[model samples]
Target chain A: MGRYFLSKLIQSLVLLFGVLFLVFMMVRVTGDPAALMLSRNASPEQLEALREEMGFNDPALVQFKHYITGAILGDFGNSLHFKTPALPLVLERLPATVQLASVGMLMAIIIGIPIGLVGGFTPGSVVDSIGRFLALIGQSVPNFWLGLMMILFLGVRLGWFPTFGRDSWNSVVMPAFVLGLPVMGQLVRLTRSAVLEIRGEDFIRTAHSKGLEPRTIYLKHVLRNVAIPLVSVIGVQFGYMLGGSIYIEAIFAWPGMGGLLAQSIGWRDFPLIQAIAVFTSLIVLLLNLLTDLAYSIIDPRIRYGR
Target chain B: MSIILQVKDLVTKFYTLDGVVNAVNGVSFELNEGETLAIVGESGSGKSVTMMSLLGLIPMPPGKIESGSASFNSEEGLCDLLQLSPEEMRDIRGGQIGFVFQDPISTLNPILTIGEQISETLIRHKGLSKEQAREQTIKLLSQVGIPDPELRYKAYPFQFSGGMRQRVVIAIAIACTPKIIIADEPTTALDVTVQAQIIELFKELRDALGVAVIWITHDLGVVAGIAERVLVMYGGRPVEIAQVMDIYKDPKHPYTLGLLRALPSLEAKESKRLKSIKGTPPDLLIPFKHCPFASRCDYAFDRCWEEIPPLISVGEQHQAACFFDLEEGGPRHD
Candidate 1:
């Protein structure tokens, strides 16, 4: 187990480097940072001074070396728009995104798993039909559209919640639900199918023949078998929630990393964009590693290297 | 002899997209206390289906018991199995009739340890506490000849070999000490060596616990070794019933004779060719007024094609579903 975890750690570190390199190269090579930072009417000498001061005039290789070293040492320079430390600025926005994504995931699991269990248990019953219909509606509608609809329906029409901005606890509900609905729909469908398939396995029949209660049979035999595959989907969907939080956060005016990244992209803030991209990639890589570890823990047949 | 269980004209049908397929058509049998009854047939002969129906294990909607009456001699009285509620049936399933299925690896949960699987049955049916259940589970495991029972108790299904897994399944089946044990092709998925060991285990359990067993299999060789009374099934119908030696030595039904001839005898000379039964089993979807095996039988005649043969008595405790006289001229081919 120790050896397995060590290999996963090494893999994650390699993945981190690959993501950092891609983000660094793409940000620098695609557009001129200094040109974007300078004013539209700035003189040529002023632009040259700014470029020299920012080390943009240095050789690309030398600049890359300095950037890599600075990034490693927590010296990400100043944000062009915020005029603050780039690392602190990005870190400050991370908790909001984490909070939103975690709550969204919690909601998805709480709502989705039970629906799936009921659907799988009865299969062709009314509960299954209703679950399928709800899942279809959840999946077909866009997240932004759903967010807008919730804001209009609950926020404006009912006057029960705020339309935008994270001011109160009630403010998190709309955005989280908007972000979670589609994911929850997919989870419900996946979990139902997984449970249905597992219920047909010979082991489950054996359990039934053993005179176990239906509840015990479901919880002990069926759920454990279904959970193995559900873990991977949960991890992948959690990563997706982080990625897809941009629209929901924007609609609710929640001051999260996704929203900050969107603003940075609009202003073409190179440091902030690079930092957010690298951070998002790191989170995704970490989630995938966690998922692999969870799978191995659940089923010991899969070994990392051996 | 006291009859322990009696199944009368049990018919199981499956409602598929095409039509109603009668998987088990009007099958009947009886089991007395402490008797080893073997249901022998080829694949799709409804041997397993008929046994599953007796226990109410057949899935509903797709598969249903169309008509049947299974009576068990319980403490109350002879209770009709078909008339019992689901809850009442649940009480009888593991409490009175224990079942051991084929494919032990698939029968045991991969996530749970062998001890847990065994204890689950004990706790549910025997009402044993966790500690008591664990103690009994260890004893049961050791009873089934699992070496180092304590360590094996913690080991998961995949940790054990296939033979050990089957032993674990048997341990679970006998956990509640039910009066009857139904082993459905228990040795089919095992190796040849393991098969003999499992059969021996069943015999030992029968001798020790005095539990009646219904061993279901398609292999005639297995029935020859373990069973006392044999019921030969063909296309969802029992074509013959007799004692073990009588069925093997003086076989009556053409299907049984064909099955016995199909098996290669060890004492046969090197130059002799082994007989093989011709043609596949008849499709149950097509309605048959005559004998289901008429198309494949060598002794099929004009009368065999026009009339269905009833299970007629040939001798004391021997019955066969054939019109021809076994003593007169054997069976005449058309």
Candidate 2:
């Protein structure tokens, strides 16, 4: 297990380099950073001064070398728009995004699993049909539109939840639902199909032959096997939730990295863009590692190099 | 020995998208206490379905127990298994009548530890606490020939080899000292040496526990190793029933003879080409009005195709469901 962890750590470190380089190159390619940042009324001399100050006049490779070296020393350069360290700016909103994303994923899991189980258990029954129908609607509807609908109805009309911004626990509900909806749909479908496939497995027959209670058979025998696939999906979906939170955060005015990213994109803040992209990709790589570890936990057959 | 189980006219069917499949057509057999009865048949002969139906393990929607009675002399007394509710069936299932399915790789739960899988049955049926179940499970592991009972108990199914997995499955089946163990092709998924070992292990467990065993397999060669009585099923019907020796020596049914001939024998001086039964098994979707094996039987005649043959006494303890008297070279009016 320790060996497996070490290998995965090495793998993630290599992947981190890939993320840093890709984001750096991507942000640079999207038009001139100085031109996008400076005012139109500024004279050529003023623009040149701004470009020289920001080192935008330097060759791309030279600038990348400076950025990479600075990044190694925990200096990702200041955000062009905020005029603060890009890494710190991204990290500041990290907790909010984490909070919203986790709460949303938790909500999806708490409700989706039981509903999916029931649907899978009965298959063609009424509950199964309804669960599948709701999952379909959840998957098809765009997250932004769903957020708007929730804000209009639950927040504006019903006064059940606040329309925009995160403050109280209740305030987080609308955006969290929007964030979790697609993931919840995926969970429902995967869980249902998993249950359907697993219940027919030879071991389940062995369980039934043993005369275990319906509840016990499902809980002990069925659920453990089902969890293997579901855990991996959850890890991946959670990563997706983090990246996809920008739209939800923007729509709801939630103060998170996603909101920072949205505002940064509008102002063409390349450093902030690079920092957020690198940070989220790192998180995704970590999530992939977690998912691999989870496989060994649920299925003994999966082994690392060791 | 007394009869432990008597399954009468077990007619199980499947409601398929194509049509109603006559899977098991009025099958009947009896298992004696402390005896090994092998049910031998080709695939889709409804051997597995028959066992599943008796255990109440058949899925109700597509597969249904159309009509049947499995009068098992369980700990709860002589109860008709078919008449029992799902809850009642559960009580007898792991308690009195344990079942080991085919395919060891798929039979044991991969995620669960061998100890947990084995002990869960003991907990449910014997009311043993976790510690007690764990203690007994380690003993069962040793009993089923799984080495290092203590360490192996904590191991998962994937950790074990195919033979070891089957041993774990056997341990679970015999966990509660069930009155009967139903092993459906337990060695089919295993290698030849492993298969022999599993059969040997099963024999040892059976002798030690003195529990009745219903060993289901398609291998006639396998039947020769462990079975006391052999029940030959063709197209979901028991075509012949007799002592293992009798079935092999004085085989009355043409299908049984064909099965025996299909097996290569080292005892024969000349290498005889192994005979293959001419036709495929009768389509289960069609309702059989006559003998199901009539089309395939070389000895099949007008009477064979005209009427459904019932199991009739051919010798003191042998029965055959056929119209022709192979020994006399004529169709028996009797």
Candidate 3:
């Protein structure tokens, strides 16, 4: 188990380097950072001064070396637009994004699992049909439009929830629902299929023949056994939620890293954009590692080097 | 000996998209106390389905129990298993009745510790405390011949060998000391040597606990060693029921005879080839109006194709669903 953990940790480091390289190259290739940062009214002298100040005049390899070294020390340089350290600026919005994503994922799991279990339990029943219908709408409908609809109905018309900005517990509901809907849909499909497949497994039959209560059988025998794959799905989904939060943040005006990302893109804040990208990728990579770890914990059948 | 379980007119069908398949058509059998009743049949003969149906373990909607009444002699009284509520049925399950499935690797949960899997039955059915159940699990494991029962208890199913895993399956089955254990081809996946050991273990557990077993298997050799009485199934119906030795010595049904002849007997001299029963089982999609084995049986006559034959007593405690009479040398349709 320790060997497995070590291997996964090493793999994560290699992946982090790969992500860093991709973010650096992708951000640099888009356009000149200095020209985008400076206003149109700025003179060539001002632009040159800004370029020199930001080390845009340096060779590409040299600039990359400097950026990589600074990133190692947790310094992603100053944002051209925000005029603050890019890393800290990204970190400042991390909690909000984390909050929204976690709550959204929790909502997704809470709502999706029961529906999946029921749908899988009775594949052709009315409940299954309704679950499939809900999954279709959830996955097919654009989240932004759903956000708008949620805002229009529950916010503007019904006055049940606030339309924009995260403040109270109730305020996060709309954006979280919009973000979580797709995840819920995906989970419903994954879990239902997983459960359906698991239903034929001999262990499930053994559990049934043991005469356990329906609740015990579903939760203990079925749920935990299915959780290994489900954990990976959840981890991947959360990583997606973090990245996908950008649109939700834009629509709702939620002050999260996603919102920061949108603003950085608009201002061509290369350092900030790269920082956010690197940070989000690292989070995704870490989550995958955690998912692997969770597998060993949930299912003893999964082993490392041994 | 008293009868422990009585299954009457148990009909199970699978409603697939293609059509409804009569998997087990009016199958009736009984399990007596301290005796092993082997349901012998080839694959798809509905032997496993009959056992699963009695436990109400068959999935509804797709796999439905059309009609059946399984009366089990519980401590409280005789309760009709088919008529009981799901909750009541659950109490009867694992508590009074246990099951050991084929493919022990798949039957045991891969995620759980051997102890956790075994102890659950004790906790659920026997009302044992956590500590008590843990102790009993180790004991059960040791009884099934698992080495280092204490350490092995914490190990997962995959950690054990196929035979050892089967022992764990047997341990789990016998945990609550259920009166009846329905083993569905429990040794099919094991090697011959391991199969012998598992068979021995079943006998040991049976004798020690006085538990009646309904052993489902296709191997006639296994039936000869373990079962007191044998039930031969073909095309979802019992073709013959007789004492184990009687069925082997004098098989009344042509299908039973074909099965016996298919075996490579050591007593017989070197032969050209092993004789196999001709034709496949009749498709269950069609209504079963005629004898299921008519097309496959060599002695099948005009009346065999026209009507179904009822199970009739040919001798004391011997029954065969056929119209042919060996002594009379002709079909006895009436």
Clashes of each: 0, 0, 0
Q: Which candidate is the best by lDDT?
A: 2
Off by over 4 Å in 1: A31-73, A292-306, B75-77, B271-273, B330-334
- What residue pairs are clashing in model 3? none
Model 2 spans with C-alpha error above 4 angstroms: A27-66, A167-169, A303-306
Q: Whose DockQ is higher: candidate 1's or candidate 3's?
A: 3
What interface RMSD do all candidates show, one decimal each?
Answer: 1.5, 0.9, 1.0
- Candidate 1, residues A1-306, lDDT tens digits: the string is 778878888999988888778877886776776777766787888888878888988888898888888877767678889988788888888788888888888998998888988999999889889988888888899989989988999999998989998788888888988888987898889989999999999998888788778889899899988898889999998997775377888899999988998898898677878777777887898899999889778765554232
Instruction: Compose the digit string of candidate 2's lDDT tens values, residues B220-284.
Output: 99999999999999998999999999988999999999999999998999988888989898999
lDDT of 3 at B23: 94
User: Least accurate stretch of 10 residues (summed lDDT) in model 3 chain B?
Assistant: B325-334
Q: What are the lDDT figures for the candidates, one per model?
A: 0.86, 0.88, 0.87
Candidate 2, B73: how far from true, in Å? 2.1
TM-score of each: 0.93, 0.94, 0.91
- Cα deviation in Å at residue B54, candidate 3? 2.5
Model 3 clash count equals 0
